[model samples]
Target: MTSPAVPRQPLLDDAIIALHAPTQAWSGRDGDIGDAAIDGIYHGDIRHIRSVRIRVADSSIETISRSIIDAATVEFGSVLRGLDDDGADPKVRLIRHRALSAGVMTEHLGLHSHRDVPLSVAVTVEVAPEFAPMQDVKAGLAATEPWHAEAIAASDGTPGRIEVRSSDGHRSFVVEAAGAAATVADTIVLRWDIELDPRSVVEIGWSATLTDDTLVVAAAANSEIAVPSTDDPRLARWVEQATRDLAALRLVLPDHPEDAFYAAGAPWFFTLFGRDSLWAARLALATDPGIAASTLRVLARLQGTKTDPATAEQPGKILHELRSAPLSLPNEGVHLPPLYYGTVDATPLWVCLLADARDAGMPEAEVRELVPALRAALTWITDFGSGTGSGFLDYVDETGHGLANQGWKDSGDSIQWRDGRLAEGPIALCEVQAYAYEAAVRGAQLLDDLGEGGGDELREWAAVLRDRFRDAFWVTTPEGRYPAIALDAHGAAVDSLTSNIGHLIGTGILDANEERACADLLLGASMSSGFGIRTLSLGAAGFWPLSYHGGSVWAHDTAVAVHGMLRSGLLAEAREVAGQLVDAAEGFAYRMPELHSGDSHDAVPFPTPYPASCRPQAWSAAAAIVCAEAYAAAP
Candidate 1:
């Protein structure tokens, strides 16, 4: 886990609020809303569950236009080279978006990249008849009115019209007051700016029925009623906050403005990155468990199901990431990546997650029915993943389009030689081996319990993994300390004594002694930070708060480690860490993003937030669930 110093913001009150505070005044500034803002608050304990739902769905034409007002003007200037002619991955492209009520003109800033525009960037507006112009908003909404307008709010005599941008630059809309109680069923139009050339407008029309709990606030946006949404009312605040925080992660990839992003820096990352999707699914499982189930099914169903040396894909392996880009460079002779499958961790981790879904309350029996697919993934790991079967795992991208290290420290030089020189792949890292061991053990459990065939074989395979892993990975020093990070194919230890050591939780392969040793290392003074735990300990040579993977304090990773500690019966320790994390979250406005930095314990009161890591990341957002598990198990 990486911990960056958190920016000082008004933290959520520490006092526990009753579940039914209807007027739980939403805190925090919609500071950025002058452009388009979203605000989500954590409603702890929604029906006594570890889940949260955000209340930031804007569906008012006035609100939408007001959002657009923040935007001066937006230009869609696209360039497409004919495919295979001279480096062109040319495809269709079309772009249409709403303009804000009154601020800057978006025309100055052109679309940046090839990433698709997202749904979050749209101005959320209500299309009710009263809100909309005299024209029937419902009929127009149902039968494709494409345009409407309304003048309301005895206050702001200025009327608001919902404009739907056509691919050809035509704008049509129905005017309506922002946030008028939905007296009639309405549809919200989200403009899809097709960045890929030849992009045709396959109009996406969607209408949602509003329930009583669904508040239509003109001041804010539409958010689902807390209790009924996620089962536990306590979780509503967090869920709402997580949903609103999703906007914080939105970025306008250079060639791709006018669309919401879910990328690295703020004002951009709104596109659906595969990793982000997986994380969102995990957290959504708590609130919108349906999303979690569907995300898994979707990813698994669309998983790279072929094993070809050229693509580095194994049958039934879930992909690391995917993108729909026509302007992307050709992969055969270039470093360009339309969609890269370089991550070695996603596969085994996916299996474990599927298995975990059941434990978190999904039906294991049902997940087990996908036996053949699971077996295919297991094969990919032991066979192709091993590359050179030393019982350890290593990934040298066969296609070279994928990542270099392939694990979380996926950046180049991520995996290193003992002397701090980068290690060459087929490099086997300890965590990957742990993931393999955990997945196999859990997979076998799912199989055996479900009366699946080869239960014996499954157990046997897991046993072999356990035997080899303990033998090959552990090294005892004179002071009774073994190396932390594992070695690459070269047999040299890539020892960087840090919290990557904590990733071994749930492997079930660590014996009591090894578990105890690892736990000691984790809770030790050097490894643990004031703000949760650091990715790499503070003293390691490679340690840096901002370093992508090596040193930042990631919430999800630490949550996993805390769970690992709880698993080993260190209840008090687990509770402390979990509490600290919740406390740390308060500093970051109570919503955990990918990570923060822990530069110094004394550094002015809080962990400095990583400038713009993906906020509301799935695992980070879902850390509360993990924390809840540890909390429930704590002594």
Candidate 2:
């Protein structure tokens, strides 16, 4: 019998990422691009440059050091032993500095010589471009056919330029280099022959500008979140590092340039995502409510206005994701339209963020402007959220090609029974119910504040949801009583002691005692990995440290629980989890990834990296701000 083919996915554990909104560059720690699967200069969902290398003829450069200066800048230092004068100290060095912007990537190469005599060398920059779509690259598919750039004659005083175009001419880019001769062969080459005087440095640079008309996101006008002052250096460093990453992730819709939201993450999800952007904005709300306000506006502009099964769009629904083209994963049986609306929680979360943003100092006028969208989203919550007649907010992928499980844990195996069985859909997740109840109550208060009237009805609706959730979602195991992860198709609780219960805290769906019960369960041995809360308890049959949502630790997930604990006045519990997040942040060098293994801290000195996790993920980076705020609220 033939074995089933293993899915091909790229590993990014060692890849260094630099990004500024729609443009990102992935390279090795030594700053060389194109050898690894994910190494490339990508602009607006297209890989513009596949490979980049710096070569010195007759001498080998040994990379000795690498430093990430900021979210969009990296520096590498290399020594040339063959060219160096014979001495204990190296006399010749090469420095490479790289930076990224909206659609441009710039690199400056500096060669320095400390020898008493002058040194002459030939330096060549080899570059190759392959116009591969983001999804194609992500799936580990073979690279699209390679394309060569055409040399554009240098005009007076300006740098020589070369233009690269895709076969379809839909995407293109230009390369410009000053004081260098350009040639096109097997690879595009920019050559410089220079002589460095004693104790002097010679520098040359080249820039690439990628152009794609189909892009929906652009670099924000300003991307700054005020870092909180803290006496604890660890908290300060985490916030500082996270602020830079969050700034680079900020993006604005081209049509709504004034409204800025965060792109989900790099190498894959570098575009507006409803759930991710909403949660990121919500998590960082204490530091900057303006971003939340703007993010609400961005998503509101794209709010669903009609029902479309193919894209999972329904009237007033929030979108799941936005991409330049349809994302199709044949192996996974997943196909998503550019503006799919498959999420179960983003709509309610949107309302929750809107109310929270207002409380966090968003301008009254701005909140007022979103009232219509708010009302429509509430309508969606009532009309379509429970369309499956599940008596709770639920999601089912009717297209069979969309996400099977539609909560934050969208993996197919995410909604599972405690005994390792995958739950059948239409799944009503416990956390979605909490988010919906909170949104209804908050939306009611906002409508009353705006004199729109409907506060009482909304409150009544929230009460019903809370009661129903209390009665139907709770389950008991040898581990004790807590809410189940979700309800399966037969109205039976899929009893999995998972992090979904963590989100129920402070949502008003659970009472004080219930919230405390959840806090205790989360801190217990099976669920608390000492690094952060695990998605699924270690004792669960389906638990695996590296499983995407089965038993992994997502920084954002822990932060959400921490935020809820703080809101519910569970200060001690909040601090405990927040500190664990701080430890995890330090483990990842203060730039958290999308998710990490749920390995016990006692077993591993540090949290293990989930090999394919995307670093600088928007929500994960924003988690730092939540942790800092939790620590700061130490009364």
Candidate 3:
């Protein structure tokens, strides 16, 4: 059978975005939507409105400036010199302030006339609702078929409303415009006629509420966490911007509303993801340990309960992702079920995060309540996890349609040898072993704390894994010796000097000298791009500045190394990597994308953007917290 070809995802590097949990709007920088591939108002995995355009009926207005107020708000300034006094300076101004919240979006349009005479203006707003599923939109298969929108007559002393529903009737939205006449054609048009006195301003607003009957995630119930500030203005601004983005990314399971987790990212993954959530919570634990507690409980609720090859679920395993429907990307050969459990590290990382949360301040009763889950997860670590018979925690996609590489880099092209050949699975990643080793050691501590048995056995298991890893995974590169990216099915080390070895440093799987060696290797010029650590070293054949996993600089990936550098007492190394990330953050306006080009700062002035990268990514945004903590600790 021929393999399916991968389709290009829509580019969003320049799109303007406004977001709140369960709601996000994408538009052109000029404040118009419907033209770009990624432009839409999305609510709970579906795009409710595809196009929203505003025009002055008889006057030409030029957009002068745009400002992002916050993650959930934006303002656009336009000028209508045609309607202004005959002067060099434009006297007529139009400002559109847009704000978003859960399932709702509102835009306040203000028109100010500084002219000396009365002015009459006709403003027309056109809205088109496609009701396209997020997957289709992401795949660039947006809905083109005509859909009907009904205009409801103005009710007692209220403006008229436009009601739109999906063809299947599973989703709907209502649009209301204050003091405007609404009409339905191919698109819903709302028009307002205003007579403004000289030196006066008039403001009109419109709002929409989108509804989806089948939503697994909802807006978080708790308030935003307290953000830490710093004396360093650069670091403070990065943290502030990241904190705002993180606050907008919070989500909760509808069934358990009190437990909240950061959604993975915007425009695409705005829902629960196991590995993403675990790492994000771990990174942000310093800001709010409560989120870690909540994230643990949320994932535990969806813990795998049975062996299923199709969905990749096994007993006590955490799910890879949760969606209202199956996520099928045939071009990429991915057909994950709604509740897939394809991740290999999430289970171990879950254990690691649990221990960290306890140390940070999770309540004793809450920790005890999870003892049963904790035990089950530990059992899974030994049984299904290590049962690959490789004496390591490894993964192989039994269903060819599932993910090929189940590590943090789940891309099919992620795991490659030094020669750029894809490694065959059941492949064991170097970092996963570290995560499992840490999980075992940490799990034992948790058991001991709660007076549970098997603590000794768990530690012994970790010791054995650590010893095996020491002898088997390390490969000698020209620079020095470091752990290979993974061990292929033939048990040959995949000799690609990657950032994976950095994760070993403070995981208890490596000794003091070994940790120092790994830390130095990561800080080497080949691995450190002066923007952040490259996923693949520049010496590797697979290295491409923009390759998704081969050589791109992932903020979270670098933050993971920074985290370990701090834990391993490599303070200077940690500070260097943290500084690179802060510099990269500034290049992206402090809202770190999912990943960026590994282009060296020596070659380019700033880090180049991975054009299609997801902004406000959960772990990427949380990386700011890690950097902040590193600065606070090292300083």
Candidate 4:
């Protein structure tokens, strides 16, 4: 006897096809099933179009092929059947071309009649605008609530034009149509009548423009950068995909229109993230130094000015995440203001980026101007970061609503001991200390070379911190001696062999012998899955292939480790890791996702994808660039 068969979910249902230009981005499902239920056109963190569907004579079209023409344009080929006058299967091909430019989207549709008889078809487009905040949309709460705006048909307008306005009259979207017999059937639908002769074609166009009551239009600027080429075909394709993904992720600030920085990722994290953007810009230094400069300036402008427990803001601290709307979860007692500053590592990472930008040959005057901000960041590291006077950087969420784990692995269960027990805060992460040390040493050099003083003070602090870290974090296990993941609240080493130690490479926090030991351990069978290094070793009690931070392989993390190995003169090890990353990229179509399962390479022919991983993530894209640059520079 056979059991009940479960319905197979459509892979394209959750697949993302996106196009963006500066502050404007449109993300949707691919193929003829482009449902706007969860997909929409977003302008500066606001959703404009919730649902858009095209039908011919009340018959839905089925997609045949789809392609991304460039960073800003997408083309889709679809066909409608059974629309003939004789009720026979029809051959009507529809070509849809969409492009985004300067906060406006233009869509062109081509309808061709392949049959011998003349065809008269009634085309209809249904659209709905939610005016929902991006955060609400990301949380999947927008569709359950009624739309915030009402669609108003434009009067005294040419042909087909409709406008939608919020109740407070603060935001509006204007949509215009051309080259077809069009009419506004109702508030949310438009009709176009097309007459095509035998073997004839007709084309129609539509444009949607978003406007605020303040009339603020973001200045348009291009973010395309040159990507390095390599002899390996797989590496070349990965670099090309990385370059395009980074270009599409660029977000221009409304106030500083001339400057551009990459948003974190698409779908959920398409906003300014302090740590994510800094790391991406740093990795892309070989490609474009301008990204590092612009990202540093933007983050400096938003640095914390005062202490506020409710939003986790503290003086001289960098922001963790920024949202366009206030986030409140009453049941969970969580309320995150738009500009929250709860990150423990971003402040130190900011100083490191400033120094990296200077090293990349930024103007001396510009680098000098940021010296004060760098000093303030260093001061935060000393005064606020080391709360226990232990000379180690640590963080604890003061507000019950803020994040529990404040490091890169911000999930609640991310920080744990070897016995699968959760560690107590204020937790000092192993990577955070390494980042702080690198920031200090590099920042001290910038201060001395840029005509600023007090380099010795930061150097002294870094020396002490490094000595303390080496003494407290290193542990001897039966298998081998490895660095602890972090220190718990009671000052006990939270000994778990994880990928966090991989970040210590190239940071100067590890000595030559220690670096070699880490490289060996990272490449060992318990830690490496042949695709990439796992977050946690397989022998650990908390190891699970699908766990977000425990056993998953993050593209960016692996890239960082490989770069460190290269810096440590472990060329063979670096190449081995890079080969696995390239193999994983092949499974992802050369567009790496945020992470994948840490399943053994021999267990499956292809890398297993994490269910909710964000594709085209900023740092993940930069990982490809980092690996390509490393290989090109290798002997």
- Using all chains and alpha carbons, the TM-scores for the candidates as numbered come to 0.61, 0.98, 0.98, 0.91
Global lDDT of each candidate = 0.48, 0.90, 0.90, 0.78
lDDT of 1 by residue, 1-635 (tens): 89975323222222111111111111122211111111111111001011111112232111111121111112122322211123355332222222221111111111222434322222222222211111111112211223233323434554232333222222222323332232223443223222223322333222211111221111112222122234333334454554444323333222323222233211112233445555444433444454444446545655677665554566656666543321122222224243455667767776776776777677665575566667777777666567676766677876555566667666675554323566666777788777888877777777777776655675677789778766666755322364446666676666666566677854687776777787677666666766677776655666677766666778877877776777677777777777667767777666665678766555648777775454445467656665665656775
lDDT value, residue 450 of candidate 4: 74
All candidates in order of TM-score, best leading: 2, 3, 4, 1
Candidate 2 deviant stretches above 4 angstroms: 1-7, 146-148, 154-159
Give the Å shift of residue 608 in candidate 1. Answer: 1.3
Across 1-635, the per-residue lDDT of candidate 2 in tens digits comes to: 99986657779989988899889999987788988999999998888889999899878989999989999999999998889766889889999999998899999999988888988889999888888887778778847665657878666756579998888787888989998899887778999999889899999999999998888788999987788777778878889998899999999988888989988987788888999999999998877778999899989999999989898898889998998888987667898988889999999999999999988888889888999999999988877899687769888998889999899999989989889999999999999999999999999999999889888988998998888888999999988999999998888999989998999998999999999999999999999999899999987999999999999999999999999999999988998999998888888888999999999999998999999999889899889888887888856
Question: Which pairs clash (backbone N, Cα, C closer than 3 Å) in model 3?
Answer: none
Q: Evaluate model 4: give its TM-score.
A: 0.91
Off by over 4 Å in 1: 1-240, 243-289, 309-311, 326-339, 417-419, 476-483
Identify the runs in model 4 with alpha carbons over 4 angstroms from their true place.
1-13, 21-37, 58-60, 83-90, 144-157, 179-187, 212-220, 329-334
Task: Rank the models by lDDT, top first.
Answer: 2, 3, 4, 1
**Winner of 1 and 4 under TM-score:** 4
Q: Tell me the lDDT of model 1 at 152.
A: 34
